[model samples]
Every structure is written in C-alpha cells, then in structure tokens.
Target: MSKKGKIISLNDFKENRKLTDPDGNPFTGVCVDYYDYEDEQKEYETRYKDGKENGLCTRWYENGQKEYETRYKDGKENGLCT
Candidate 1:
C-alpha cells in the first residue's frame, strides 16, 4: 500500500483550516469496496459509504458482459444504466 501523510489527529478533519472542499463539503466519512484484488483483468467494482453504495458502480456477467452501470447519491441508487 502507498503511504500518505501522518494521520496526525481528528483536528485535521475540520473545516476550521479551510480544509474542506470549495463547496464547503466536509468529511466524506467511511467508505467500503467490493474489490477484485486477485484478477489480472478488470472487473466490476462497487463502493459504499455511509452504509450505502454512493458512487459509480459496475457489475459484470460471467460471460464477460457488463450488466450494470449507474451512479449513486448518499449511498442510494440514482442515474443511468446498461
């Protein structure tokens, strides 16, 4: 794994230092992933945050066909498909 800066402390997770995004968006919080760590070829990936799938998600069929494509919001299904 690649190393980033030191964790420092929770104080770094604050907006008091202009640390947030331009939209004043604060912490993105915890995120989880369904990873294909063993495959040499790319495969479907699903990511979750706030206990929901909240980003670009993809799914594939065993026949090597892509089965799902979509976006998410706050971890819920949102837009686009196939």
Candidate 2:
C-alpha cells in the first residue's frame, strides 16, 4: 500500500499536538500506525482531512488480518462500521 502522508506514532496522534505536517501545515491524508516499535507490522490505517478522521478507517491484527473497518465523516462515524 502507498502511504499518502505523514507517518506518526499513535501517541503523537493521540496527543494531538498541533497536528501539522512536516512543513507546519494542517495534516491531510493517511496516518498509519504500526504494531511494533520497529514499524514491522501495521496496526491501523486512518484517513484524515484537515486533522479529522474523514474516511474509511481500518484496524488490523498483528498477523496481517483485518480486524474491522469504519467510515467517518468530519471525525464522526458516518455509516455502518464493520
């Protein structure tokens, strides 16, 4: 999969500090998190729009299986999540 934007730690995403890209702009695009400290396995792939969750968000198992998927709009769930 192609990463669309910045790759930040889950802690940084949760801390929500400024939430800007490397150039000090509002973050837009995908923010990926890993299951391991070394970034070996993907934990989640969430799409963002102006710093809000605004698209299909997916979680994965450490074994590379998808756990669930949820759609969001303006940071809120917009439809059936599965």
Question: In the order shown, what is each candidate's alpha-carbon RMSD?
Answer: 9.7, 4.2
Q: Which segments of candidate 1 are over 4 A away from where they belong? A: 1-43
- The sequence of per-residue lDDT tens digits that candidate 1 reaches over residues 1-82 is 1013222112242433212223444334332222343552345655444334467877776555777788877655687776
What is the C-alpha local distance difference test score of each model?
A: 0.46, 0.72
Question: Can you write out model 2's per-residue Cα lDDT over 4-75, one digit (the tens) per residue?
Answer: 534443225563532456555666788777788476688998888876788999999998899999998877
